[model samples]
Target: MNNPVITIKNVSKSFGKNQVLENISLEIHSGEIFGFLGPSGAGKTTLVKELVGLDTPTKGENFVLGGKMPSLGLMERVGYMSQADALYGELSAKENLEFFAALYGLKGPNRKKRMEMVMEMVQLSDDLNKLVSNYSGGMKRRLSLAAALLHEPELLILDEPTVGIDPVLRKSIWDGFYDLKKKGTTIIVTTHVMDEAEKCDRLGMVRNGKLIAVGSPEELKENTNSGTIEDAFLVYGGA
Candidate 1:
């Protein structure tokens, strides 16, 4: 916590005339898995997209790894995996890795080593030669995760990473997250799943493009006099 890896200050975003984020402000410390929980259209993805510099805030500032928003220089130190799969269908898994790894300025031995390490972590080492077009939804999700970790980035931003993944595989992926955290990687994940929210070191519950609560899972439930995160969210929603 000595040096926070990510900071958002009064950040807001809009597309055309519709506001997607409203004065969102938060901090993500290094070496932690922080979860953003919300229903669909709750601005979880918008906030994360802003953090990754894919979209700029309309009114405020966002800083990652100490640099201001949308800085090309900071891209190498941050890894991002959006909810949508962004892979080339014609490319083999290994080829896809090669392309993205190169984008992060990786080459030679470092690139190969990282590529192998990420594939192994995602339990897809054997599928390196498979064409992505043949991959199932879960397989593609695993591949996306592998690609995101290929750079060993100091900060990881994952959006609904486990949506289509099976429970066993999902647990393995979360295990990988913890291992990365131990190695000092700051991870930010957006999910609506309550169980996943409970696993985070801290959580931000958002609704209608606004943050309703920020705390550890236990703290949130206790504060709301609820037995679970879902219950707490309901209380916050005045249900």
Candidate 2:
């Protein structure tokens, strides 16, 4: 196994009286695609938000790249895509990419190269000059993904990245993910989609703020005595 790239140590989060995560602890290895598999409101997104430094844990700690999270210095080393499309509606896709690239301190030829590369990865190169407001839901999602890849961060955190994507495009995006993994990038993706979960190197199954199981897809199926990931999830979910 590669060195630990992310470590969640007994993490917990609560909003008001509601606890979203409880005593969650896990380690994600470098250069692997780790999936957070669960249904909506299962605290998957909350856990990811803390991992990306967008939110703080109510208790315990999260470390990425060996440093404590919510650190500004680590922001540039991590790429994040939220469940929502956080794009500028009036700006052209290229402009949006440029704006975010500038934020990451990318400039000149290097910036241009990364912009082009990410656009191609998401298959949105042709729509570069189009205004984001005019783009479809799926297009916006792809563009958001491209933005996250702008800095070529070592860690990528995505929340339901393929929610609005068509099957063909979703496959293309997953292919891109594998390509990134080959290049030694670590990815953490949260999804309720069963097929996508099978593609992960390992999975942490979350349900009602608890991490019930952690293992490879095949291992999960074998341990559950199930034929598919979905059935395995059901076994873990007590259904």
Candidate 1 backbone collisions, by pair:
none
Report the C-alpha displacement of residue 162, candidate 1, in angstroms.
0.5
Task: Write the residue-wise lDDT of candidate 2 on 45-131 in tens digits.
Answer: 999999999899999999999899999999879999999999999999999999999999999999999999999999999999999
What stretches of model 1 exceed 4 Å from their correct place?
none
Worst 10 residues of 1 by lDDT: 1-10
Give the TM-scores of the predictions, in the order they appear. Answer: 0.97, 0.98
| Residue pairs in collision within model 2 | none
Clash totals for all models, in order?
0, 0
| Model 2 TM-score on a 0 to 1 scale | 0.98
| Cα lDDT of model 1 by residue, 119-154, tens digit | 999999999999999999999999999999998999
